[model samples]
Target: MIGYLVLALLGLFVVAFYAGHRRAVASVEGDVARLHSRPSQHGLYLALLSCVPALLLLVLWSLVTPAIEASIVRARFAAEVAEMSLPQVQAFIRDARAIAFGGIAGFPDETKEAAAALFGTLHGWSVRIAVVLSLALAAAGYLYGIARIAPAFRARHMVERTVRGFLILCSVVAILTTIGIVLSLIFESLRFFQQVPIYKFLFGTHWSPQSAFTGAGAEEGAVNTDIFGAVPLFAGTLLITVIAMLVAAPVGLMSAIYLSDYASRRVRAVAKPMLEILAGIPTVVYGFFAALTVAPFFRRSGEALGLDVASESALAAGVVMGIMIIPFVSSLSDDVINAVPQSLRDGSAGLGATKSETIRKVVLPAALPGIVSALLLAVSRAIGETMIVVMAAGLAANLTINPVEAVTTVTVQIVTLLVGDQEFDSAKTLAAFALGLVLFCATLALNIIALRVVKKYREQYE
Candidate 1:
């Protein structure tokens, strides 16, 4: 019914737009210059008036009708509802709605049949009233808007004002969403810190939350907070990120320089897109490749060299993660390099500098800030990656930096901690939120540093 109502509102909007447009043209005797707004603006004004109010009405009616039906049905079946617990009563209402709307219902009885019948009747009347009232409101809005349209009507002003208000609303939503996330993280981490001290979580060496309880059948809040140390996870994250940067930074930057400065136009066009396709591939696919292919190859090579390597090691995951974020660095660095002014290159050439010298001395210095920003963003991407680490790097929170050692990252630990059915109030579960808070702070700091570098160097070049 709501879908049909929406389609009806759409048709009314089309009719209202045409009517308003023709009426405006007739009022001006087809002389567009005599009107304060364009004919399209008048049409849009009428369309918004005819459709927006009806859409809002439909949304409001849809939201409230189910609750209204439930309330009235519960009142009609008070005796039946009074015998059931809250969950059972809620289930009974769900079953009644399902039967009324044509679905299999659990625990159907005579009382439920009567309730379903009553709900169906009420729902029918509610939908009908909603449709009639919505159409009436849309018709009234069409009339009011059409009546107001004239040679001197400020339709464009009103439309622009409405659009500006919508943009402001979107901005406010984004800001509020960020604040909500930060507050949730802070609140949850504080709960975790209440059980585990902040000093232990930040500076302790062990990272075993599974053994948090001292013994069997321990009471709540009796956790061995010393095992909640995060140093190993922090070390593993830094190790993988460093390895990924070693792979990504130089390769990505060199490719970007080649594409921006040295490659022919045809080669650039083909190669850049092909390189960026890596970014579009799912991270899960890269995880599978790392786990199934790269890890084994590394193990075999280590064996041939008479060295022991873990089957699941940081090297495989870090290398694959680097390959994944290559596009982030290459695409951004290419754009930054290309954005260096052509005049700088031209002046360098006039001074008898070769292309290499010009790129090294002039273009690189100009684009240095943007390149650094791109690299820092890639580092953040590397830090946040969970799939590759989970697949290729085993979930052992070892404090070793050896590339061939099996280690876990903060994101991977967060996933491990939250995977099963567990008590949210326990330090084990709440530890995920603390890890998340730490990860958030790290990435936020990287972004802030990137912005600072961009600002500091941008002035010298500009």
Candidate 2:
């Protein structure tokens, strides 16, 4: 029903646009030069007036309808719900809604069937009320806006102001969302800190949340704070990120240089897209390749070379993650390198420099900031990757830096802690938020450092 109303509003908006456009021309007897704004601006203003208010009404209606329906159903079946707990009441409402909407319900009884029937009736009435009121509002807004269209009307100004306000609202929303996330992480991490000290999480050597006190009511269960030591997780994350950068940075940078300076147009058109296809492949598929192919290949090769390699090792995950990030680094670096003015290369040639010398001495220095930024961004991507790590690097949480050994990153540990139904108040689950907070801080710091590096090099180049 709501979808139908939205489609109707869209149609009305289109009609309003053409109507306003014609009205603007008709208002001034086809003397568009006398009007303050263009016919298109008038049309846009009318369209926004027609649909914006109706869209807001529909949003409000959608939020209110479920609550209103749940209340009416509960009041009608008061006797059935009187003895139920809050969760049970919520469950009953859910089941009734599901049954009314042709969804599969958990437990459908005669009481629930009656509730579902009532729910369907209420939903129909509510949708009718919403549609009628929304359409009326849209019609009224259209009439008012059209009536206001005159020779002196500033439709462009009004439309611009509305768009500007919308952009500001979007920016505010993004900032607030970031602030909210950080605050929530801090709040949850503080709760985890109450269970386990911050110092232990920061400095202790071991990483074993499985043995930590995770039960809600068991006071007798040993709360081993030392097991929550995150040092090993940090080491594993650093090890993997370093390995990934080792594989990605030089190779991606060299490929970008080749593509930007050496490759012909024909070669670039084919090679660049083929290289970028790596980035388009799903990370889960990369994880599978890492697990099934890369890890096993490494293990077999290790045996041949008289080396011991874990079946699920950090080396495999890091290498595959590096492969995944190659496109990101290569694309960014290629664009940056290409952005270096041709005059710089021409000047270098005028100085009797060879192509290799000009590239090494001039082009690379000019593009260093962007190249560094790309590599840092790739590092951030590597640090956040969980699938490849989870599949290739086993959840051993070993404090070793050996790439051939099994190790888990901070992201993997965070995921491991939060999987399935969890008691949020327990140290185990809260630990995920704690790890998240640390990761967020680390990423933010990395970005700040990258910005500084970019600024410094950019100043020199400029």
Candidate 3:
């Protein structure tokens, strides 16, 4: 039944779109032999008119239906429980509501009877109300659009303006969503800082989030232990990121250089996409390989060399993350290198510089900004990566510099912080937001620096 209604709404929209287009073309053709805009634009204009309002209605209805049904059920229960004392009635009502929603399995017999009746009525009314209103709105929009189509109608211009508005709206929505995310992080971090002083949280050397968990009868003046020191986690993140950069930058840059500067058409064709296939592999698969394959090998090798290696080592995770980011760095670097004028390379060759020297002195310097941007992008990916770090890097949050000794990262901390049963207001959970804010700021700063470098280099060449 729902599917049929949706199909009917769609069919009405299609009809309205065709009607608006035909009217637009007819009006324009009568005024002049050639229309100001193409007939396709007229069709698109009508399609937008036909669909926009009805789609908006459908979206609005979907969002509100559940809330409306819940309210109706709650209200019904409130009325039914009026005879009982306030506290007992409230408790009974809460349990009854939970039972009705399948949250709890059993309820008092009287409460159950009342709840079932109320829920049935609420569900039936809400569904009928939503379907009727949605269809009516869609039909109304179609008819209104048909009525407006006439000989003097400027449907082409109207449609173009509507399309422009839609594009602007989409862009605004994206920007607003980003702003909302940052604001949410800021607010949550503020709550976290209220419990753990911001200064201590940021610069503390130990990262035992368990310190935030207080036990019964814990002394107030005694060291309010739950080591919130974030230094080791940050260090682990930086160390792994550096390792990834070391692995990815040289390899990705070399590949980009070959593709952009040296590779023949055949070589480029065969190799570029093949390298991209690395990016397509799921990070979870990389996580498995890190945990199951690489870490054990590193452990055995370290033992042979008379060194201790943690089973879940940062090196294994970092290497795999680097492999994951190689395509992003190589592909972007290749495009930017290719975009550099051919004349510059030719001039270096004319000066009798060897190809390698020319590449190092001329091409690389010219593409430095773009290369920096690619590296920064890779760094951002490394820092934000969660799955590989969580699976391979032990969650102990050790405050150590030794890569072979298992250390955690900010992302890993965030995962463990909120993964299990957690209260939203607890210091442990809120710490995730604080870490997120710092990570966001760090990545944002790197991106800004990369952009500045790219801009400066572009100016130098121009």
Candidate 4:
């Protein structure tokens, strides 16, 4: 609530700043020395100065407050719980926190009262301090800008630079988040490798994570600990991705071509968005469609052909996933194909080439980079997709190449490993992180290769 108030205050300040600057500029005109910027630029300069610094501080405060409060709470309890074992103390702290935050109840009366008092005081003070500090900074900046609104202020250029920097910071934050996730996955995978050999995980033929917790004395040196082969999951993921690409690529590309090259303007206007409507459908809907409808149809069809087929078949899941990816491929490819210079098409036509020949040899080749990028993007989506596979693809990790067989992908395994009740410290659960690391690396490699391919294709046109 305080954050919203701060934003509201900042917005009001901007409006005031703009109004004041415009009034000042209109009144002064050419009577005084030349103004450093236009009236609007001067307003923007004041507005940015009033908001940016305070917003930055508010963001920093928000991020650090939780850690600080947690530390304080831990310190308060440390002496009281010192006699307890580390694990027990930790558990107690967790329970106390839950009670304090209204997540759970049934704490000791004294502990609950103390926790409530502490949390209320800290939270109230934190919010008050944040609001006070931000308001003060904004007021100061606003006043300074107002005072400097004389003809000498270089407001426009400074505001532009500040806005550019702000945008850059936002982009950097997104990139940094991706980097952090990849690093976390790498670290957890390293921990997993400590328990199971990397070679066994990568190359072994059998993959039964449930076996890691088997037997009466499985905690001791288990015989089957080294059987964590990822071949089947990898193969299944690849097969599904390939099948999806096969379904998406030709259909999406041809759709793009028709929209860009052949469709009448009115037809294109109606059909483009209609086709893109496929993208809006949720994956969960697709999941049920695959599981309830597609899988049964496949099974019945296979039975008719006198062939053995699993009710939850890979073909069913892969085909559904492919359909899900069609919009991504078509939309991206369409934009890229349209972006190709019309001069190239015109030049081709002047050389006695037919429209189909011009498109085939000229437009498609030129737009190949974007098409490859779109396909790679779709491949990444297929690899990471969870819900459809979880529902349609069976959980059995069969190490086979047959598309008709029941197969599981990495995401399915990850979902199963982490779902329901599970210990986070167990090998079974930790294997999900290991799988995530592999998936991340695989997708990153695909994107890089795709980017390179696109760049090379662009160079040919250049």
- Show pairs that collide, candidate 4: none
Pairwise TM-score winner, candidates 1 and 3: 1
C-alpha TM-score for every candidate:
0.90, 0.94, 0.88, 0.88
Worst 10-residue lDDT window, candidate 4:
215-224
Q: By the lDDT metric, which is better: model 3 or model 4?
A: 4
What lDDT, from 0 to 1, does candidate 2 have? 0.92
Regions of model 2 farther than 4 Å from truth: 214-219, 457-462
What's the lDDT for residue 118 in model 1?
A: 96
By TM-score, is 1 or 2 better? 2
Q: How high is the lDDT of residue 374 in model 1?
A: 95
TM-score of 4: 0.88
Task: Please write out the lDDT profile of model 1 over residues 4-32, one tens digit for every residue.
Answer: 98998999889888988898899999999
Q: Rate the local accuracy (lDDT) of all candidates.
A: 0.93, 0.92, 0.80, 0.84
Q: If ranked by lDDT, best first, what sequence of candidates would result?
A: 1, 2, 4, 3
lDDT score for residue 123 of model 2: 91
* lDDT per residue (tens digit) for residues 1-462 in model 4: 675867677686668567657755865774534676777778877787787788888889989997787678768766767788978666665666666667775555676557656866787798989888988988898887777776767777887899899899999999999889988898888888887888889887788888885744465645355557898899999888888888999999999999999999999999999999989999999999999999999999999999888988789999999999999999999998988999999999999999999999999888888898999988998999988888888899998878888899999999888889887767777899999999988998988988897788677665
Model 3 lDDT, full chain set: 0.80
Best model per TM-score: 2
